[model samples]
Target: MLEPILVAARGRIIAGVLGGAAGVVVIVLLVLALTPRAGGGTVLVPDETPAPRWAPPADPPVAAVTPGPYGIAGLAEPAWVARTAKATGIPRRALAAYAGAAMTKASAMPACGLSWTTLAGIGRVESDHGRHGGSTIGADGTATPPIFGPALDGDGVARIPDSDQGAIDGDTKADRAVGPMQLIPQTWRNWHTDANADGREDPQNIDDAVMASANYLCRASTGLDTEAGWRRAITSYNDATTYIDAVARAAEGYRTAADR
Candidate 1:
Protein backbone atom coordinates (compact mmCIF):
# COMPACT_ATOMS: atom_id res chain seq x y z
CA MET A 1 0.00 0.00 0.00
CA LEU A 2 2.83 2.32 0.96
CA GLU A 3 4.61 1.49 -2.31
CA PRO A 4 1.46 2.35 -4.30
CA ILE A 5 1.01 5.58 -2.34
CA LEU A 6 4.68 6.50 -3.00
CA VAL A 7 4.27 5.77 -6.72
CA ALA A 8 1.15 7.97 -6.82
CA ALA A 9 3.01 10.78 -5.08
CA ARG A 10 5.91 10.51 -7.60
CA GLY A 11 3.37 10.83 -10.48
CA ARG A 12 1.81 13.93 -8.83
CA ILE A 13 5.25 15.51 -8.38
CA ILE A 14 6.15 14.95 -12.02
CA ALA A 15 2.82 16.46 -13.16
CA GLY A 16 3.31 19.43 -10.85
CA VAL A 17 6.81 20.08 -12.20
CA LEU A 18 5.57 19.83 -15.80
CA GLY A 19 2.65 22.12 -14.97
CA GLY A 20 5.03 24.66 -13.44
CA ALA A 21 7.29 24.50 -16.48
CA ALA A 22 4.28 24.97 -18.80
CA GLY A 23 3.18 27.98 -16.75
CA VAL A 24 6.66 29.52 -17.14
CA VAL A 25 6.57 28.93 -20.92
CA VAL A 26 3.11 30.52 -21.15
CA ILE A 27 4.32 33.54 -19.15
CA VAL A 28 7.33 33.96 -21.45
CA LEU A 29 5.08 33.83 -24.54
CA LEU A 30 2.69 36.37 -23.01
CA VAL A 31 5.62 38.69 -22.18
CA LEU A 32 6.95 38.39 -25.70
CA ALA A 33 3.52 39.18 -27.21
CA LEU A 34 3.10 42.20 -24.95
CA THR A 35 6.58 43.58 -25.64
CA PRO A 36 6.91 46.33 -28.30
CA ARG A 37 8.96 45.51 -31.39
CA ALA A 38 11.68 47.74 -32.67
CA GLY A 39 10.44 50.49 -35.09
CA GLY A 40 6.86 49.36 -34.57
CA GLY A 41 7.01 47.20 -37.75
CA THR A 42 8.93 49.93 -39.69
CA VAL A 43 12.58 50.14 -40.78
CA LEU A 44 14.92 53.03 -39.97
CA VAL A 45 17.92 54.39 -41.82
CA PRO A 46 20.66 56.98 -41.42
CA ASP A 47 20.89 60.27 -43.30
CA GLU A 48 21.83 60.05 -46.97
CA THR A 49 22.43 63.69 -47.79
CA PRO A 50 25.15 64.29 -50.36
CA ALA A 51 27.94 66.82 -50.20
CA PRO A 52 27.65 70.24 -51.82
CA ARG A 53 28.87 70.65 -55.38
CA TRP A 54 30.69 73.72 -56.65
CA ALA A 55 30.29 75.03 -60.22
CA PRO A 56 32.16 77.55 -62.36
CA PRO A 57 30.62 80.93 -63.10
CA ALA A 58 28.79 81.84 -66.28
CA ASP A 59 30.95 82.34 -69.40
CA PRO A 60 30.46 86.01 -70.22
CA PRO A 61 31.76 87.78 -73.30
CA VAL A 62 34.91 89.73 -72.54
CA ALA A 63 36.06 92.92 -74.27
CA ALA A 64 38.68 92.86 -77.01
CA VAL A 65 42.29 92.38 -75.96
CA THR A 66 44.91 95.07 -76.56
CA PRO A 67 48.60 94.33 -76.87
CA GLY A 68 50.49 95.14 -73.68
CA PRO A 69 54.12 95.01 -72.54
CA TYR A 70 53.40 91.73 -70.69
CA GLY A 71 51.99 90.02 -73.80
CA ILE A 72 53.92 86.91 -74.85
CA ALA A 73 54.38 86.25 -78.59
CA GLY A 74 53.25 82.64 -78.80
CA LEU A 75 50.93 82.97 -75.82
CA ALA A 76 48.84 85.73 -77.33
CA GLU A 77 45.18 84.98 -76.65
CA PRO A 78 44.76 81.54 -78.26
CA ALA A 79 41.50 80.47 -79.89
CA TRP A 80 41.15 77.95 -77.09
CA VAL A 81 40.89 80.83 -74.64
CA ALA A 82 37.69 82.03 -76.23
CA ARG A 83 36.55 78.48 -76.85
CA THR A 84 37.12 77.44 -73.24
CA ALA A 85 35.65 80.68 -72.01
CA LYS A 86 32.55 80.05 -74.04
CA ALA A 87 32.40 76.38 -73.14
CA THR A 88 33.39 76.46 -69.44
CA GLY A 89 31.76 79.81 -68.64
CA ILE A 90 35.09 81.33 -67.57
CA PRO A 91 35.70 84.90 -68.65
CA ARG A 92 37.63 85.14 -71.91
CA ARG A 93 40.08 87.68 -70.56
CA ALA A 94 40.65 85.62 -67.44
CA LEU A 95 41.16 82.49 -69.50
CA ALA A 96 43.74 84.27 -71.63
CA ALA A 97 45.64 85.49 -68.59
CA TYR A 98 45.59 82.03 -67.01
CA ALA A 99 46.73 80.35 -70.22
CA GLY A 100 49.51 82.84 -70.77
CA ALA A 101 50.72 82.43 -67.21
CA ALA A 102 50.63 78.63 -67.49
CA MET A 103 52.53 78.75 -70.77
CA THR A 104 55.12 81.10 -69.32
CA LYS A 105 55.61 78.83 -66.33
CA ALA A 106 55.90 75.79 -68.58
CA SER A 107 58.68 77.47 -70.53
CA ALA A 108 60.48 78.29 -67.29
CA MET A 109 59.85 74.91 -65.57
CA PRO A 110 59.00 72.32 -68.19
CA ALA A 111 58.65 69.52 -65.65
CA CYS A 112 56.02 71.28 -63.48
CA GLY A 113 53.04 70.29 -65.63
CA LEU A 114 51.28 73.47 -64.64
CA SER A 115 48.09 73.89 -66.65
CA TRP A 116 45.76 76.80 -67.32
CA THR A 117 42.91 74.81 -65.85
CA THR A 118 44.68 74.67 -62.47
CA LEU A 119 45.31 78.41 -62.45
CA ALA A 120 41.75 78.98 -63.60
CA GLY A 121 40.61 76.72 -60.79
CA ILE A 122 42.49 78.79 -58.24
CA GLY A 123 41.17 81.99 -59.83
CA ARG A 124 37.60 80.75 -59.70
CA VAL A 125 37.95 79.88 -56.06
CA GLU A 126 39.94 82.98 -55.10
CA SER A 127 37.72 85.63 -56.65
CA ASP A 128 35.60 84.08 -59.39
CA HIS A 129 38.34 84.85 -61.93
CA GLY A 130 38.31 88.49 -60.76
CA ARG A 131 34.62 88.74 -61.69
CA HIS A 132 33.36 88.59 -58.15
CA GLY A 133 31.27 91.60 -56.93
CA GLY A 134 30.60 92.70 -60.52
CA SER A 135 34.27 93.27 -61.22
CA THR A 136 35.49 92.93 -64.82
CA ILE A 137 38.90 92.15 -66.33
CA GLY A 138 40.47 94.84 -68.46
CA ALA A 139 42.48 94.40 -71.66
CA ASP A 140 45.63 94.82 -69.59
CA GLY A 141 44.61 91.91 -67.32
CA THR A 142 43.63 94.13 -64.40
CA ALA A 143 40.43 94.01 -62.44
CA THR A 144 38.29 97.07 -63.06
CA PRO A 145 36.92 97.47 -59.53
CA PRO A 146 39.72 95.49 -57.82
CA ILE A 147 38.92 92.51 -55.59
CA PHE A 148 39.75 92.57 -51.85
CA GLY A 149 39.07 90.12 -49.06
CA PRO A 150 37.62 91.06 -45.68
CA ALA A 151 40.00 92.60 -43.19
CA LEU A 152 42.00 89.89 -41.44
CA ASP A 153 41.68 91.53 -38.02
CA GLY A 154 41.71 88.26 -36.06
CA ASP A 155 38.10 87.76 -37.03
CA GLY A 156 36.70 84.55 -38.50
CA VAL A 157 39.49 84.60 -41.09
CA ALA A 158 43.24 84.85 -40.56
CA ARG A 159 44.64 87.18 -37.91
CA ILE A 160 47.61 88.42 -39.92
CA PRO A 161 48.33 91.93 -38.76
CA ASP A 162 49.33 94.69 -41.18
CA SER A 163 52.35 93.27 -42.98
CA ASP A 164 52.61 95.95 -45.70
CA GLN A 165 51.92 98.97 -43.47
CA GLY A 166 48.84 99.98 -45.48
CA ALA A 167 50.81 100.14 -48.72
CA ILE A 168 49.50 97.12 -50.75
CA ASP A 169 46.08 96.55 -49.19
CA GLY A 170 45.74 100.02 -47.61
CA ASP A 171 44.78 98.57 -44.23
CA THR A 172 47.23 99.38 -41.47
CA LYS A 173 45.09 97.81 -38.76
CA ALA A 174 45.24 94.31 -40.29
CA ASP A 175 46.46 92.65 -43.47
CA ARG A 176 43.78 91.93 -46.06
CA ALA A 177 44.14 89.72 -49.09
CA VAL A 178 44.24 91.74 -52.31
CA GLY A 179 43.83 91.09 -56.04
CA PRO A 180 42.04 88.22 -57.73
CA MET A 181 44.22 85.53 -56.14
CA GLN A 182 43.41 86.72 -52.60
CA LEU A 183 47.10 86.86 -51.72
CA ILE A 184 48.16 88.39 -48.44
CA PRO A 185 50.52 91.35 -48.43
CA GLN A 186 53.42 89.27 -47.12
CA THR A 187 52.93 86.56 -49.74
CA TRP A 188 52.74 89.17 -52.46
CA ARG A 189 55.96 90.72 -51.23
CA ASN A 190 57.69 87.34 -51.27
CA TRP A 191 56.36 85.95 -54.59
CA HIS A 192 55.55 89.14 -56.49
CA THR A 193 56.53 89.18 -60.18
CA ASP A 194 56.10 91.54 -63.12
CA ALA A 195 54.51 89.29 -65.71
CA ASN A 196 53.29 92.37 -67.55
CA ALA A 197 56.95 93.41 -68.00
CA ASP A 198 55.98 96.87 -66.82
CA GLY A 199 59.03 96.94 -64.47
CA ARG A 200 56.75 96.84 -61.44
CA GLU A 201 55.40 93.80 -59.55
CA ASP A 202 51.76 94.65 -59.08
CA PRO A 203 49.39 92.21 -57.44
CA GLN A 204 46.43 94.05 -58.95
CA ASN A 205 47.47 92.91 -62.44
CA ILE A 206 46.05 89.54 -63.43
CA ASP A 207 49.15 88.72 -65.47
CA ASP A 208 51.40 89.24 -62.49
CA ALA A 209 49.04 87.51 -60.10
CA VAL A 210 48.59 84.46 -62.32
CA MET A 211 52.32 84.11 -62.87
CA ALA A 212 53.05 84.50 -59.18
CA SER A 213 50.41 81.92 -58.31
CA ALA A 214 51.82 79.49 -60.85
CA ASN A 215 55.38 79.95 -59.67
CA TYR A 216 54.33 79.49 -56.07
CA LEU A 217 52.47 76.30 -56.87
CA CYS A 218 55.35 74.93 -58.98
CA ARG A 219 57.79 75.62 -56.17
CA ALA A 220 55.60 73.81 -53.69
CA SER A 221 56.15 70.37 -55.23
CA THR A 222 58.14 68.48 -57.88
CA GLY A 223 55.23 68.11 -60.30
CA LEU A 224 51.46 68.36 -60.13
CA ASP A 225 50.90 65.56 -62.65
CA THR A 226 50.20 63.18 -59.78
CA GLU A 227 47.38 63.60 -57.28
CA ALA A 228 49.76 63.70 -54.30
CA GLY A 229 51.81 66.51 -55.78
CA TRP A 230 48.71 68.40 -56.84
CA ARG A 231 47.20 68.07 -53.38
CA ARG A 232 50.43 69.21 -51.73
CA ALA A 233 50.63 72.25 -53.96
CA ILE A 234 47.02 73.22 -53.35
CA THR A 235 47.28 72.56 -49.62
CA SER A 236 50.25 74.90 -49.46
CA TYR A 237 47.98 77.55 -50.93
CA ASN A 238 45.12 76.87 -48.48
CA ASP A 239 45.14 74.14 -45.86
CA ALA A 240 41.37 73.72 -45.76
CA THR A 241 40.10 70.47 -47.30
CA THR A 242 36.90 72.11 -48.53
CA TYR A 243 38.88 74.71 -50.43
CA ILE A 244 41.01 72.01 -52.02
CA ASP A 245 37.99 69.94 -53.02
CA ALA A 246 36.22 72.94 -54.51
CA VAL A 247 39.29 73.88 -56.50
CA ALA A 248 39.74 70.30 -57.75
CA ARG A 249 36.12 70.09 -58.82
CA ALA A 250 36.31 73.44 -60.56
CA ALA A 251 39.50 72.43 -62.32
CA GLU A 252 38.00 69.10 -63.45
CA GLY A 253 34.90 70.90 -64.67
CA TYR A 254 36.97 73.30 -66.74
CA ARG A 255 39.03 70.46 -68.15
CA THR A 256 35.96 68.39 -69.09
CA ALA A 257 34.17 71.38 -70.56
CA ALA A 258 37.21 72.40 -72.56
CA ASP A 259 37.59 68.85 -73.90
CA ARG A 260 34.00 68.97 -75.12
Candidate 2:
Protein backbone atom coordinates (compact mmCIF):
# COMPACT_ATOMS: atom_id res chain seq x y z
CA MET A 1 0.00 0.00 0.00
CA LEU A 2 2.80 2.46 0.94
CA GLU A 3 4.73 1.81 -2.33
CA PRO A 4 1.63 2.41 -4.59
CA ILE A 5 0.87 5.87 -2.94
CA LEU A 6 4.50 6.96 -3.44
CA VAL A 7 4.44 5.99 -7.16
CA ALA A 8 1.16 7.95 -7.82
CA ALA A 9 2.63 11.18 -6.26
CA ARG A 10 5.82 10.91 -8.41
CA GLY A 11 3.78 10.56 -11.64
CA ARG A 12 1.70 13.81 -10.84
CA ILE A 13 4.93 15.83 -10.16
CA ILE A 14 6.59 14.69 -13.44
CA ALA A 15 3.49 15.55 -15.56
CA GLY A 16 3.29 19.13 -14.03
CA VAL A 17 6.97 19.73 -14.81
CA LEU A 18 6.53 18.57 -18.48
CA GLY A 19 3.41 20.86 -19.01
CA GLY A 20 5.37 23.97 -17.65
CA ALA A 21 8.31 23.29 -20.04
CA ALA A 22 5.92 23.05 -23.12
CA GLY A 23 4.27 26.48 -22.26
CA VAL A 24 7.74 28.16 -22.01
CA VAL A 25 8.65 26.78 -25.50
CA VAL A 26 5.38 28.25 -27.02
CA ILE A 27 6.08 31.78 -25.46
CA VAL A 28 9.64 31.87 -26.90
CA LEU A 29 8.37 30.92 -30.39
CA LEU A 30 5.65 33.70 -30.33
CA VAL A 31 8.19 36.42 -29.32
CA LEU A 32 10.58 35.44 -32.14
CA ALA A 33 7.78 35.34 -34.84
CA LEU A 34 6.36 38.82 -33.86
CA THR A 35 9.74 40.67 -33.78
CA PRO A 36 10.73 42.84 -36.86
CA ARG A 37 13.82 42.03 -39.04
CA ALA A 38 16.59 44.60 -39.85
CA GLY A 39 18.49 45.13 -43.12
CA GLY A 40 21.98 43.51 -43.33
CA GLY A 41 24.25 41.63 -45.74
CA THR A 42 23.25 38.22 -44.38
CA VAL A 43 19.95 39.05 -42.58
CA LEU A 44 17.69 38.20 -45.60
CA VAL A 45 14.76 40.19 -44.13
CA PRO A 46 11.83 42.09 -45.80
CA ASP A 47 12.08 45.96 -45.47
CA GLU A 48 9.74 48.81 -46.53
CA THR A 49 9.44 48.42 -50.33
CA PRO A 50 10.84 51.48 -52.24
CA ALA A 51 8.24 53.69 -54.00
CA PRO A 52 7.90 53.14 -57.73
CA ARG A 53 10.27 55.41 -59.72
CA TRP A 54 9.14 57.69 -62.62
CA ALA A 55 10.82 59.95 -65.22
CA PRO A 56 10.19 63.73 -65.67
CA PRO A 57 8.99 65.35 -68.89
CA ALA A 58 11.27 67.44 -71.14
CA ASP A 59 10.77 71.04 -72.52
CA PRO A 60 10.33 72.00 -76.16
CA PRO A 61 13.18 73.62 -78.13
CA VAL A 62 13.17 77.22 -79.55
CA ALA A 63 13.61 77.83 -83.31
CA ALA A 64 15.71 80.68 -84.82
CA VAL A 65 15.54 82.29 -88.29
CA THR A 66 18.18 84.06 -90.44
CA PRO A 67 17.45 87.64 -91.60
CA GLY A 68 17.94 89.18 -95.08
CA PRO A 69 20.45 91.92 -95.94
CA TYR A 70 19.66 95.40 -94.54
CA GLY A 71 16.72 93.90 -92.63
CA ILE A 72 17.60 95.97 -89.55
CA ALA A 73 16.35 99.22 -91.05
CA GLY A 74 13.10 97.54 -92.00
CA LEU A 75 12.57 96.75 -88.31
CA ALA A 76 13.44 100.21 -87.06
CA GLU A 77 10.93 101.38 -84.44
CA PRO A 78 9.78 104.94 -83.82
CA ALA A 79 11.67 104.93 -80.53
CA TRP A 80 14.84 103.93 -82.31
CA VAL A 81 14.42 106.69 -84.90
CA ALA A 82 13.80 109.23 -82.17
CA ARG A 83 16.75 107.98 -80.16
CA THR A 84 19.07 108.15 -83.16
CA ALA A 85 17.92 111.69 -83.95
CA LYS A 86 18.52 112.69 -80.34
CA ALA A 87 21.96 111.14 -80.36
CA THR A 88 22.81 113.13 -83.48
CA GLY A 89 21.72 116.36 -81.72
CA ILE A 90 19.54 117.25 -84.68
CA PRO A 91 15.92 118.42 -84.34
CA ARG A 92 13.37 115.63 -84.45
CA ARG A 93 11.00 117.34 -86.92
CA ALA A 94 13.85 118.45 -89.17
CA LEU A 95 15.34 114.99 -89.27
CA ALA A 96 11.96 113.43 -90.04
CA ALA A 97 11.24 115.93 -92.83
CA TYR A 98 14.67 115.45 -94.34
CA ALA A 99 14.46 111.68 -94.08
CA GLY A 100 11.02 111.68 -95.66
CA ALA A 101 12.14 113.94 -98.50
CA ALA A 102 15.20 111.83 -99.25
CA MET A 103 13.18 108.62 -99.07
CA THR A 104 10.58 109.97 -101.49
CA LYS A 105 13.16 111.23 -104.00
CA ALA A 106 15.30 108.10 -103.84
CA SER A 107 12.24 105.87 -104.22
CA ALA A 108 11.13 107.85 -107.26
CA MET A 109 14.58 107.23 -108.76
CA PRO A 110 15.24 103.68 -107.57
CA ALA A 111 18.67 103.62 -109.19
CA CYS A 112 19.87 106.17 -106.65
CA GLY A 113 21.72 104.36 -103.87
CA LEU A 114 21.85 107.36 -101.56
CA SER A 115 20.56 106.35 -98.11
CA TRP A 116 17.87 108.68 -96.69
CA THR A 117 19.71 108.95 -93.38
CA THR A 118 22.92 110.14 -95.09
CA LEU A 119 21.00 112.75 -97.11
CA ALA A 120 19.20 113.96 -93.97
CA GLY A 121 22.50 114.46 -92.15
CA ILE A 122 23.83 116.41 -95.12
CA GLY A 123 20.76 118.64 -95.17
CA ARG A 124 21.24 119.44 -91.49
CA VAL A 125 24.76 120.72 -92.07
CA GLU A 126 24.20 122.51 -95.38
CA SER A 127 22.13 125.72 -95.17
CA ASP A 128 20.37 124.13 -92.20
CA HIS A 129 17.79 123.09 -94.76
CA GLY A 130 17.25 126.71 -95.93
CA ARG A 131 16.36 127.83 -92.42
CA HIS A 132 19.43 130.08 -92.16
CA GLY A 133 18.06 132.06 -95.12
CA GLY A 134 21.52 132.80 -96.54
CA SER A 135 22.86 134.68 -93.48
CA THR A 136 21.36 137.74 -91.77
CA ILE A 137 22.41 140.96 -90.05
CA GLY A 138 22.40 141.22 -86.24
CA ALA A 139 20.35 143.79 -84.24
CA ASP A 140 23.49 145.96 -84.16
CA GLY A 141 24.20 148.31 -87.11
CA THR A 142 26.14 145.58 -88.94
CA ALA A 143 25.09 144.20 -92.34
CA THR A 144 25.45 140.40 -92.20
CA PRO A 145 25.35 139.73 -95.96
CA PRO A 146 24.45 136.45 -97.71
CA ILE A 147 27.16 133.78 -97.63
CA PHE A 148 25.38 132.36 -100.70
CA GLY A 149 22.46 133.46 -102.90
CA PRO A 150 18.75 132.62 -102.60
CA ALA A 151 17.32 129.11 -102.06
CA LEU A 152 14.20 129.39 -104.26
CA ASP A 153 14.06 129.02 -108.04
CA GLY A 154 12.23 131.19 -110.61
CA ASP A 155 9.04 129.11 -110.09
CA GLY A 156 9.83 129.09 -106.35
CA VAL A 157 11.43 125.69 -106.92
CA ALA A 158 14.98 124.93 -105.73
CA ARG A 159 17.24 125.46 -108.83
CA ILE A 160 20.99 125.54 -109.37
CA PRO A 161 22.25 126.16 -112.95
CA ASP A 162 25.02 123.99 -114.52
CA SER A 163 26.93 126.91 -116.12
CA ASP A 164 30.10 128.14 -114.34
CA GLN A 165 29.06 131.73 -114.91
CA GLY A 166 25.60 130.99 -113.49
CA ALA A 167 27.19 129.40 -110.44
CA ILE A 168 29.43 132.41 -109.82
CA ASP A 169 26.76 134.95 -110.60
CA GLY A 170 23.15 133.75 -111.01
CA ASP A 171 20.35 136.23 -111.53
CA THR A 172 17.93 134.49 -109.17
CA LYS A 173 18.75 134.75 -105.45
CA ALA A 174 16.57 131.63 -105.09
CA ASP A 175 19.17 129.70 -107.12
CA ARG A 176 21.66 129.88 -104.21
CA ALA A 177 21.28 126.55 -102.32
CA VAL A 178 18.83 124.70 -104.52
CA GLY A 179 16.73 122.02 -102.86
CA PRO A 180 16.31 120.50 -99.41
CA MET A 181 19.54 118.58 -100.14
CA GLN A 182 21.27 122.00 -100.65
CA LEU A 183 23.29 121.41 -103.84
CA ILE A 184 25.23 124.59 -104.74
CA PRO A 185 25.21 125.89 -108.35
CA GLN A 186 28.84 124.90 -109.02
CA THR A 187 28.87 121.65 -107.04
CA TRP A 188 25.63 120.58 -108.69
CA ARG A 189 27.17 121.23 -112.09
CA ASN A 190 30.02 118.78 -111.33
CA TRP A 191 27.66 116.07 -109.95
CA HIS A 192 24.70 116.66 -112.26
CA THR A 193 23.57 113.86 -114.52
CA ASP A 194 20.05 113.85 -116.05
CA ALA A 195 18.87 111.13 -113.62
CA ASN A 196 15.25 111.98 -114.26
CA ALA A 197 13.81 112.03 -117.80
CA ASP A 198 13.93 115.84 -117.56
CA GLY A 199 15.39 117.61 -120.67
CA ARG A 200 18.15 119.46 -118.75
CA GLU A 201 20.24 119.20 -115.54
CA ASP A 202 18.14 120.20 -112.53
CA PRO A 203 20.06 120.01 -109.25
CA GLN A 204 17.43 121.78 -107.14
CA ASN A 205 14.87 119.09 -107.95
CA ILE A 206 14.70 116.47 -105.22
CA ASP A 207 15.05 113.71 -107.83
CA ASP A 208 18.22 115.23 -109.19
CA ALA A 209 19.58 115.88 -105.68
CA VAL A 210 19.05 112.27 -104.58
CA MET A 211 20.64 110.84 -107.73
CA ALA A 212 23.62 113.18 -107.51
CA SER A 213 24.14 112.33 -103.84
CA ALA A 214 24.01 108.62 -104.64
CA ASN A 215 26.49 108.95 -107.49
CA TYR A 216 28.82 111.06 -105.38
CA LEU A 217 28.75 108.51 -102.56
CA CYS A 218 29.40 105.59 -104.90
CA ARG A 219 32.32 107.38 -106.51
CA ALA A 220 33.87 108.41 -103.21
CA SER A 221 33.28 105.06 -101.52
CA THR A 222 36.07 102.58 -102.41
CA GLY A 223 33.92 99.92 -100.76
CA LEU A 224 30.32 100.85 -99.91
CA ASP A 225 30.01 98.31 -97.12
CA THR A 226 33.27 99.18 -95.40
CA GLU A 227 33.62 101.63 -92.45
CA ALA A 228 36.57 103.39 -94.09
CA GLY A 229 34.69 103.80 -97.38
CA TRP A 230 31.72 105.31 -95.50
CA ARG A 231 34.07 107.72 -93.76
CA ARG A 232 35.65 108.86 -97.03
CA ALA A 233 32.30 109.30 -98.77
CA ILE A 234 30.80 111.32 -95.92
CA THR A 235 33.92 113.50 -95.60
CA SER A 236 33.81 114.26 -99.31
CA TYR A 237 30.14 115.34 -99.03
CA ASN A 238 31.32 118.18 -96.81
CA ASP A 239 34.99 118.74 -95.85
CA ALA A 240 34.12 119.64 -92.24
CA THR A 241 34.97 117.21 -89.44
CA THR A 242 31.60 117.89 -87.79
CA TYR A 243 29.76 117.10 -91.00
CA ILE A 244 31.68 113.85 -91.50
CA ASP A 245 31.08 112.74 -87.92
CA ALA A 246 27.38 113.52 -88.07
CA VAL A 247 26.88 111.64 -91.34
CA ALA A 248 28.94 108.65 -90.22
CA ARG A 249 26.98 108.39 -87.00
CA ALA A 250 23.68 108.68 -88.85
CA ALA A 251 24.78 106.09 -91.42
CA GLU A 252 25.85 103.67 -88.75
CA GLY A 253 22.49 104.08 -87.04
CA TYR A 254 20.70 103.46 -90.35
CA ARG A 255 22.77 100.36 -91.11
CA THR A 256 22.19 98.97 -87.65
CA ALA A 257 18.46 99.59 -87.76
CA ALA A 258 18.15 98.20 -91.28
CA ASP A 259 20.11 95.10 -90.36
CA ARG A 260 17.84 94.40 -87.43
Question: Which candidate wins on TM-score?
Answer: 1
Query: How would you encode candidate 1's per-residue C-alpha lDDT over 17-83 as one tens digit per residue?
Result: 1132122110000000111235321111222433123323222222236543456412644565667
Tell me which residue pairs clash in candidate 1. Answer: 59-89
- For model 1, the stretches where C-alpha displacement exceeds 4 angstroms are 1-69, 72-77
The 0-to-1 C-alpha lDDT of every candidate, in the order given, reads 0.60, 0.37
Q: What is the TM-score of each candidate against the true structure?
A: 0.72, 0.40
For candidate 1, the lDDT comes to 0.60
Clashes of each: 1, 10
